[model samples]
Target chain A: MNEMIENLLSHRSIRKFKSKRLNQQQIETIVCSAQHASTSSYMMAYSIIGVTDDSKKERLAEITGQSYVKHNGHFLIFCADLNRVTIKATNDEYENMLDNLENSEHFLVSAIDAALAAQNAAIAAESMGLGICYIGSIRNNIAAVDELFHLPKHVIPLFGMAIGYPAHHPESKPRLPIDAVYFENGYQDHEDALDRFDEKIGNYYAKRSENNRKDTWTDQMKRRFQKTIRMDVTNHVKNKGFNKK
Target chain B: MNEMIENLLSHRSIRKFKSKRLNQQQIETIVCSAQHASTSSYMMAYSIIGVTDDSKKERLAEITGQSYVKHNGHFLIFCADLNRVTIKATNDEYENMLDNLENSEHFLVSAIDAALAAQNAAIAAESMGLGICYIGSIRNNIAAVDELFHLPKHVIPLFGMAIGYPAHHPESKPRLPIDAVYFENGYQDHEDALDRFDEKIGNYYAKRSENNRKDTWTDQMKRRFQKTIRMDVTNHVKNKGFNKK
Candidate 1:
């Protein structure tokens, strides 16, 4: 495989980072690489907030329940921002600004746009020899996150990413078997493939150097999905001016 | 910049593709690269459905209103899948399985995971001299798409990506100014940046070789956001069993 594909295939989330900061030039180049990611209709309905204040980082770390948030070289919150388009609509005196921004399709569009850009940033960071971790737990306290970031309506903070020099290199976790996650022509039954993956992951968890455990993938998934996870996000999304229909 | 960053910085969506098909090995390698992308909490809540049948491709093309879907080297629908976890929950006899699978946080997690994987797949394709175009228009007719792909509940079609050898190379579209999209510490006003970007994009449209026009970014966004762009997506999402409170 080529270097780009090799870099992509070897991706591992880094939770421990050295006490060093990315220079301003590096941050700018990374963000520029993010901007180059394809946007739907060139809408670029996303914004990234770089948090460097220690107090603010501490607060965000508390929100995510991940202490590393404060110590990472940099923390960036990626948001699905319809506000830019809203601004244009208002500036042009469009009558359906609210209605247009409130649609579920646009919500999905912005979220996907943010995600696509964030992934680009992640890959770029990796290519530059920086380790990165995506903090989806930011949603654990979405309201506080929004308030902390001063996010306006039509701008939902989707996720946060932490980039820094690696202090630890963890083994890449196993994924579902190809058959289980890839269907040919149409969706197919993958129970057999899932069964195989469960065995493989069970072995992986047991063999990993850190956080070793005897948990199968199915066991963890069952534990997670046995009850509601983050039920507050519905209200949070609505309060952030989305899914209003 | 290294080759990877340079490749990322120069991404342009390829709408027209050569008629050649990707070999089995190429498809497997690309899918494996996609599987390597990061997932939230290791919940690999996504699936890719590859469509190669001409009839199915034609139907999908009609749904997207983009004829290139039929002619692309390969087409894959990236789905935000909670069904796998739901199956584990059901088989494990976990209470509240339905409620857990229906939450908005999991919905966002699965969609982001799928997008990350798709972007990796796109980058991998680009690395191999293949071209990619993301088809967000798949949402234009979600129910039909679900039916076409035999998708189940809790498995929404997030987006489709068409990959193939390039038949036409388009110029990279202009993005919002860096200041407008990247904030420091907290959100800031970007009116001046947007105005400058509008002028720059106006020039971009006027100078591009193919389908050249005099439209500004603001003009396009204003036209798009004037009314509901895809109002049916709400019902479609709900019918696919998501965003329910």
Candidate 2:
């Protein structure tokens, strides 16, 4: 495979990072590449927050439940933003009234756009030998994240990513089988596909250090499902101006 | 900028494509690259369906409300899947009995994973000089798409993409100003951000032909938001056996 393909194939999340920081130019290049991503109707309905302050990062780290959030050399929060467009429309004397920005197609587009850009940035960073990890925990405390980031109306933080040189190499985690997930024309029921999943997951856990939990994928998933984690996101998002209706 | 960054920056949606087809090796390489993307906890909660049959593409085109889908040289559907994991867990005697596959975390992870992989595939295709257009309309008629693809429970069509050698070059769409989207530590509420947005959008529309409709950004967004387009997605997803809660 070519270098790009190889890089993509060998990709892994690196939570541990070196203390060295990324320069503004590198950040700019990444952002510029992000801007090059496709937008629906040319409306780039997304924004990114570059978090650099030590104290601020600490607060964000707490909000996300990822302690490493504060230690990463570079931190960014990607957001789906539609308020900007609405505001712009109103200013241009165009009819730009949006009763609900949160639950509208506007939010989904912005979120997806932000995600696309974030993926580009991640790939670019990896190409540059940077290690990165996406912090989904940002949703653990959505309101706090919004407050910390001073997010405007109709802007919601979709995900956070921490970037830096890798301090350690993590194993390439296993993925579901091709047949299990891959469908033909319509969705096929793969009744037997999971037969191999348990074996593979068991082996993966076996290789990990005993100090860590020896739980299989199924076990972990069940444990996760049994409890309510961040159960307030729906209400919180609604309060934050997402009109789910 | 490097060639990779340049390719990313210069990316444009090429609706018109040449009739050339990609070899199987090329397809494998692209899929392999997609599989290499980071998955949440290694669940790899996504699958890709390659569509070479013309009739299916035509149907896909109809579903997406884009006639171009029928004539695209290549088309593929990316799906968010929990079937692989769930099916495996069910058969594994040691695995937990509780079903977590229907939870919000599972749904979100699968969506994000699918999106990341799709983006990687898009980038890989572009690197090989192929043009691609992501089809969001697949979500518009989820049931129709699900039936077309024979999707089982716990699988949702996230998006579709058409790929081929370019027959026509499209314009590079403009992006919102960096500040309009990017914030610092928290979200900065700038009162005039919207006014500036109007001016920039007006500028963009003014540069296009009168056929462009000169629709302000807000006008287009508001039109889309006025009614529910993907209103059934949540219910459809739930019907797919995913407990979004």
Candidate 3:
């Protein structure tokens, strides 16, 4: 593999960070990389909010329940935004566009758009020798995140990213076997050694320096799904004027 | 900017491909890059279907109404998959996870996970000197696509990436201004020169080699959204046992 592919394969999300802020050029380059991601029909339905104010960062960290959000060198909230299109429609008297943006299809478009850009930003940051973690916990308290970010209707914060120098290097988490995730022409589903993957994860956790756990992947997943999580997310998003229809 | 970021910034959707297929090594590298992307709580809620059969590619092209889909170096369908979890739940008898994956939040998680992986694949391909175009048009006939791919329940294909050697390198589509899509601490929305963006897009469309048009961005936006597109997406996903709640 090339150095770029090697860099990509070696990704490990960093939760603990040193206090080293990204310079202006790095930030711009990362954002520019995000801008270049292919959108669905050029509808760049996403935005990045750089939270530099200490208080705001603290509150955002609180919202996510992850201290890294506040303590990271730079915190960015990636938002799925159709508000810009709504703005254009209202300004240009294309009122039907508002209804269009409210559809579930547009919701998927904006969410996918935001995620693609955020992944680019993540890769760009990682290539620059910085460590980053995706903060999906921002969605745990979606209303607070919206309030904290002052997001408008048709714009919702999908996730956050904490970028900085790594204070600790975590082990690269093992992914599903390539056969399990990739199919030939059609999905190939059959019984496999579930214990094999769980064992690999189990070993990784066992050998890791911090927060060791004996739980298998399946156990964690079951524990995760059995409880209600962000049950109001749909209501929150709908009230924000997205997917209301 | 570094070469990687430059490569990311230089992305252009290639509609015309030289009929060269990616070698096994390149394909593996690209998929590895995608596999390394972060997933929500490591659920890894996605799968990829490689449509390598010529007949299937032709069918996919017809489904997408894009000829390039039929003649790419590789075509990959990124799918948001809660079905894998459902299968695990069935095997291990943790049925609550089934209900969990049905929630709207998990739907967003799966979609975001798929997009993140797809973006990584796009970057990895571009780094290897391949061109890519994201195919969102598969949603036009979701049922046909599902039938063609034999997608199981709780697995929805979010998009496809047609990667190939470029026969044509189109100009990078201009995006919204950095100031427009990005904010500081909070979202900043105010009226600016909408005509300026319209002019920028107008000039881009005017200068491009293929299919030049006199339409501005706002005009295209109005035209695209006014037409009801993919009205069945929500119902389709719901029928697939995702996000019905």
lDDT, candidate 1, A1-245, per-residue tens:
88888898899999999999999988998999999988988889999999999999999888888988998899999999988876665544545777666677888889999999999999999999999999998888888888888998888988999999999989888878999999988888888888898899888888888888898887788787766667888888888778878
Worst 10 residues of 3 chain B by lDDT: B85-94
Docking class of 1: high
List runs of model 2 lying over 4 Å from the truth. Answer: A89-106, A191-193, A208-219, B90-105, B190-215, B241-245
What ordering of candidates by lDDT runs from best to worst? Answer: 1, 3, 2
> Mind giving the per-residue lDDT tens digits that candidate 3 earns over B1-245?
68778788888888888988998888888888899999999889899999899998888888889998898899999999877665556544556676666678988999999999999999899888899999999898888889888998889988899999999767777887788877888889743745678888888888888788887776776678877788888788888876656
Give the CAPRI class of candidate 2: acceptable
What is the C-alpha lDDT profile of model 1 across B132-152, one tens digit per residue? 999998888888888988998
- TM-score: which is higher, 2 or 3? 3
What fraction of the reference interface contacts is present in each model, in order?
0.83, 0.50, 0.75
Model 1: residues >4 Å from true position, as ranges?
A91-95, B91-95
Q: Between candidates 2 and 3, name the one with more favorable lDDT.
A: 3
Shift in Å, residue B149, candidate 3: 1.6
Ordering by DockQ: 1, 3, 2
Tens digits of lDDT, candidate 3, A1-245 = 67888888999999999988888888888888888898999888898999899998878777788999988888899999877765656544556776666678888999999999999899999989899999999888899888977898889899999999999978888897787788888988743745677778888888778788787776677677777788889888878876656
lDDT for B105 in candidate 1 is 77
Candidate 3: stretches off by over 4 Å = A90-94, B90-94
Q: Assess each model's interface with DockQ, reporting 2 decimals per model.
A: 0.80, 0.46, 0.74
